[model samples]
Target: MHKEVTIYDIAEKLSISASTVSRALNANSLVSKKTQQKIIAMATSMGYRSNTFAANLRMQRSNTIGLIVPRLNSYFMSEVISGIESVTNDAGYNLIISQSMENVDKEISNLKTMFNNRVDGLLVSVAAGSNGLTGFDIFRDRKIPVLFFDRAPHGLTVPSVTIDNENAAFLITQHLIEMGAKNIFHITGHQSVSVYKERTSGFKRALLAAGLPFNENQLIVTDLSEKAGIAAAKLIAELKGDGVFAANDSCAATCMNELKLQGFKIPQDVKFAGFNNDLISRNIDPALTTINYPGFEMGKVIAAKLLDHLSHKSDLHSSPLITMKSELVIRASSNYKP
Candidate 1:
């Protein structure tokens, strides 16, 4: 039977104390660079495997960050996960990711599991129907850092990283107006979500600022899915709105396709735009006008900021907010020239 190799075996082989091997393995500053290399080489050759669970217990930290998002099915979230994992892996941290599917009950349950696992930090993009977070007090009591991103809850003291949704929506709507669109409609997700709520506000603000007609009926709320997009397109066809701004590219792309099937000439009979600069935005028939949301960058910032708070000292933002920059990309879908 083969015996499990331990750090003690490596230390005895190198004629050094186990403490020195431990320090070298953890990359302690006290260990010389040349000695660390030797130790690592010997450890690797000897088939030494680290017991991370035991090491974490000794350090009183799990080196794990819990991430909760509304859903992971979107391209935006995929980019975010890629960026976050890159930083976390480099920093020797692991991630425990969960999706809430926009369900408040599931979100609360996810929070409980994270807390039980004793994660060192947490990142969240809140679910719909969760306007506020109350189950986070346990994490707060334990001194675990929690950062919100993209879809932060309302009235929470937790620091958040996101783009200016209100302003972005305003810019998109204003661009439609500039394109000679007299009647504009903003198709979005659950009105309760902060991003959607802010976008609706921006849409109204742009309409009011442009001296155009503003009413609640112009704000079409949906699940922001492909089916929702088709339904919204039908509604827009009946309403005869000259401009349509969906909250995401998927909805906007599908809706635009449906509109084209309905015999409407894009940018002529009905100008359209979307958000998130997703791949679909550029591949469609006429291409979609959209806002270039930096999902990957946002993820990096969220992870880095939390890591900064965890390592050496606390470096949290005093304002509890980090607003990322987003830009509008005009395309054939909305760039109408009279």
Candidate 2:
């Protein structure tokens, strides 16, 4: 049977006292930094592993953070998580990730689990329902730092990292208007989510600014899926709208395909645009016009903020919102000059 390597073995190999080795391993200030580095190197060469359980017990910290997101399947969501992992891993921390699957009940349950695990901090992208954050009070009471990103909940003054959704939406709508599209239809996800609500507001602001009627009939809300895109295209065909702005690239791409099948020409018959510069947006016929949302950057910002709070380097109360930048990417789909 193989035996586990210990600090005492490392000390014996280095001809040093076990107490000195222990102090070096724990990064005690009493141990000189140079000696600590040498001891660490020797420990690594000797295949010694520190007892994290004991270390954590002494420090009263888990060295772990909890992350909750609406879903993990999308490219945007996955990239955000990857960015977070990159930052946390370099900082000697681990992430415990959970997906709410856009269900309020599941989100509440995940929150409970995070609390039970005694995570050092929490990062969240809220789910779609109004009751998605029923468990938020517990974290507040426990004095745990919670930072939200992307689909943050409204009315919660918790520090968050997000882009100006309303501004981005307004830009896209205005671009379609500038392209000589008079009747523009807007397709989006559930308005309960803050991102969708802000986007809807932006769309309305643009239409009203252009002296166009705010037609409720032209707004379609769905799950932002490919199926939703198909349905939205069918509705637009019936309404005979000149342009469309779907909330996501998947829906936008699928909507374009559906519109083409229905004998509509891209940008010629009906101009199309979407949000989130997803790969599907670029790969589609007449690449989609979209807003380049900085998902990965948002993730890095949120992780940095949470880590700063944990390290006492920043105060969450001072800044309630950390806004990232997003830009409009014009493509062939919305550039037809005819």
Candidate 3:
């Protein structure tokens, strides 16, 4: 195995004092830029890498921000993480991400791990049934800055970046109604989740406002997975509706595919709309109508805010609840063109 190169090696190679090499590497203003450049060049030539763990230990900071999400495979979440990486990576900070898989117990375990690691900050999008921030007291007690996005914890005053879910849902439902859908079915996840609840509420509101009957039977709650979408499609086949609104595009796309296999013509037979204008939504045989939730932009905004707070450029206590803008994207799946 190759031995690790150290500052002592660089110092010896350059015939300079170890302290001088250290100051130069640290970019101390006391050391001339010319000397610093020479030390840096020598260090690079020797394949020297700084011991960041040792440095972080001395600073009493990990220089790492922990992130927790419900799931990591989703297109929206992936885009959000990419945005976060773009900013945090450039700032020389690292992200430690984990998924709860929508389980509260797993979320608590992930939180404990992040806390034990002493992450500089935490970003989370709470899992289903994470009810009332019960597991987040430790962060509050320790004064750790926590930012929630997308499916955030309810009844908690935490800094967050997300879209106006209810308003977006209202617009989508109203659009379906405008397209002449009277009996619309809403397929979503747990109502305990704020995003799903807000979306379901908006769907009911649109129906009630239009003097259309808001059938309790039409609200189908599930995990919103692709398998769930297929199952929901099978059920919908038995009890059909004029339209359907899913909480996310993945399920909507799969549901559309399943419906097609079951001989249901989209838009003409059943208009379908979903949240998050994911690539799958656009690529489906009949592109699905959806709300453009701007996942990447939301990520960038959230990461910037968190980084600013960590760097002390912004106050954590004064962190704002940021809401990103979204618009309904009409597509062939939901639009009826004679």
Candidate 4:
């Protein structure tokens, strides 16, 4: 095995004190540029590497931010993470990402690991089953900044960023109603989540505004998976609703496929709309009409806000909630007429 080079080795070669070498390596103001360059050159020649643990101890900062998400496989979540990475990297910060896999226990474990790592800040999109976060108290107690985006905890005082789910769902529902869709069926995920709850509420509100009867049988709550989509389509076919509003595109695509197999003429027999303009939405046989939720933009905004708070030590009380606008995209799936 190759021997590990140390600062003492560099100091011995340069005939300088280890303290001077340490100061020079850390780019401290006390070290002159000439000495710093000489020390760096000698260290490079000796194959020396800076000890991040020691440096972190000295600076009292990790220079790393922690991020926790439900899952990384979803297009929307992946795009959001990419956006966050872009901003954090530009700001000279490293991000440590972990997935909770929609499990409350996994989320708790991830939180503990992040806290132990002493991350400068944390960004989280809470998992599905996470009722409340008792473990996050470590961050609160330590005064580390924590920001939530997307699926955030309910009734928390932490800063959060999300889209206007109610308005977006209402707009999409209205669009379906205007296309001559009567008896609209709403397919959504777990009602425990604020996003799904708000979406369901918006759907009901749209029905009320249109003076249409809202049927409890028309609402289907599932796991928001492709399989759930197929199951939802079967239920929709049995119910024979004229319109279907799926909470997400993945489920919408699966439902559409199943409905097509059942010989239902899309848009003509059952006008359909989905949320989140995912790539799958456009690739489906009849392109899905959806709301552009801007996941990437949401991620970028959340990360930028957290970084700003860290740098400026700004009070988070000013903006408790940051809601982004969503735009509706009209595509073949919801276009009943030519």
Candidate 5:
């Protein structure tokens, strides 16, 4: 087996101090350019490699930010990740990303790994089944900055960056009401998730405000996946509401397509609305009205907030929540009667 090569070996072979070799390898200005070049060439010839992890540990920093999300297989998450990577790479920081797959145990395991690695900070969009910020107290105990985005829990001191789900849902419902929807059924995700819970609240609020009866069966709780959307369609058809609002586009589009197959005319029979202006919203026969939740922009802001705090440019302790702007988009799916 080949012997491992390190800086000391290079220094000994070149007849120089290890400090000089170290500075040269690290590009310290203290080492002369000519000497640094010689050291580099000798190090390369000796097959020596830099130990960045050990070096970063000695400096009490990782230059790495940990990101924990619920899942990676979605357009919204894809855009968010792209935005985060763009900023973090430009700032010379690395991201250690992990997904919980909507499992609380997996999320906890990820958090433990990030803590052990001594990440500079952590950004998390909690899992769907997460009860609350129980396992996350370790970061706070260590004074490690932690930020939550999108799917955060209620009553959190850990600052969050997310759109106002309640307000967006309320607006969507209100629009349907103004369009003469007497009964608006809402398709949503697990009620344990704050975003979905808030959306439900908004839907109910709008219905009550409009003096429309809020039916218990009108609110369907599902994972909001493609299959869940298809399954919910049958129940939606039985409920036979004049308006249907989904927490996301995937479910809304699938339900719309399924309802269409059942001979239901959109807008003319049932006005459809959804959150997250995903591509499917546009591809549907009559474009679906939705809330334009800016995942990419939210990602940029979340990374910037934690990075700024780490760099001592700002503090986030006082600011509990940062709300991103979500615009209500109107389309052919939601047309009002004169």
Candidate 6:
């Protein structure tokens, strides 16, 4: 293995004191700009790597933040993480991310790992099956700032940022109602999640407002996977609803394909609408109509807010909720009338 370069080596090569080299590397204005540049150039040429642990201890701060998400494979979650990285990297912070795969046990393990690493802050989107915030007590006790985005824990004091799921779902449902969809069906994920529960509530509210009956058989709850979408399509075929609102675009696309195979016409016999406005929404034949939840923007906003709080130590007690807007995109899937 090659020998690691250090500040002492840089100082020796530059014929300067190690203290001067350290100050220059730390960007201390006490050192002249010319000297700092010369030292940095030499350090870069020598392949000198800063010891993050040592630096963190000396500064009493870790420049790394921890991020925990239910899963890492989805397009929406990936976009959100990308946006977070952009903002955190610009602010001179590193992100250590982990996925729970929607398991509560794995989510607990990830939280313990993040706490052990002593991250400056944490960002989390709790697992769907996570029943409570018991695992997050370590952060709360240690006074480490934690921010929740997207799938947040309900009734928590931690700062959270999310779009109004109820309003968005209500709007989509109203759109279907306006299209003469008397028997509308809603395909949703686990109702334990605030997002899914709120969406279901919004669907019910819309039905009541329109004087339409909310049929128990019309509501299908599943895991929001492609297979679930296929199953939902088959189930919907059996039930035969005029309009369908899926919790997400991937499921909607799958259902759309399956429904077509089962001899159902798109937006002719049955209209469809989905959420998240994901790429699949545009790629699917007879493009999916969905709600634009702005996952990427939500990430950027949450990251910026967390960084600001870390830097300023701002009082979070005043306002705990940061809500973003969601817009309904009327595409071919839901646009039945000419």
TM value for model 6: 0.84
Per-residue CA lDDT of candidate 5, range 1-338, in tens? 99988788989988999999888877778999999899888877776754332346456678889999999987788889888988899999999999999899999999999998778999999898785576888988888998889988777556889889999999999999999888789999888788999999999999988888887999989989998888888888887788999999999999888889999988888899999988888888889999998988988998999999998888977786888899999999987574
TM-score of each: 0.84, 0.84, 0.83, 0.85, 0.85, 0.84
In model 5, the clashing pairs are: none
**Per-candidate local distance difference test:** 0.89, 0.88, 0.86, 0.87, 0.87, 0.87
Kindly give the stretch of ten consecutive residues in candidate 2 with the minimal lDDT sum.
49-58
- The pairs that clash in candidate 2 are none
lDDT of 3 by residue, 129-244 (tens): 99637777898887888998887778766787778888899999999988877778899998988999999988888888888987688999999999988988887778878789
Error of 1 at 66 (Å): 0.9
**Which regions of candidate 5 deviate over 4 angstroms?**
1-55
Question: What CA RMSD would you report for each candidate?
Answer: 5.9, 5.9, 5.4, 3.9, 3.8, 5.2
Model 1 RMSD, rounded to 1 decimal = 5.9
> TM-score winner among the candidates?
5
Q: Which stretches of candidate 4 lie over 4 Å from their true place?
A: 1-54
Query: Per-residue CA lDDT of candidate 2, range 59-156, in tens?
Result: 75788899998888788988898889889999999899999898888899999999888788999999988443578899888789888889777987
Worst 10 residues of 6 by lDDT: 49-58
> Whose lDDT is greatest here?
1
Across residues 1-338, which tens digit of lDDT does each residue of candidate 1 receive? 98988889989999999988888888777889899889888988988864432346457688889999999988899999888998999999999999988998999889999988879999999998886556778887888888999988887766999899999999999999999998998899888899999988888899999999887778888899999999998999999889999999999999999999999999899999999999999999899999999989988988988998998455665668878999999999999967
The lDDT, on a scale of 0 to 1, for candidate 2 is 0.88
C-alpha-based local distance difference test score of model 1: 0.89
RMSD of 4: 3.9
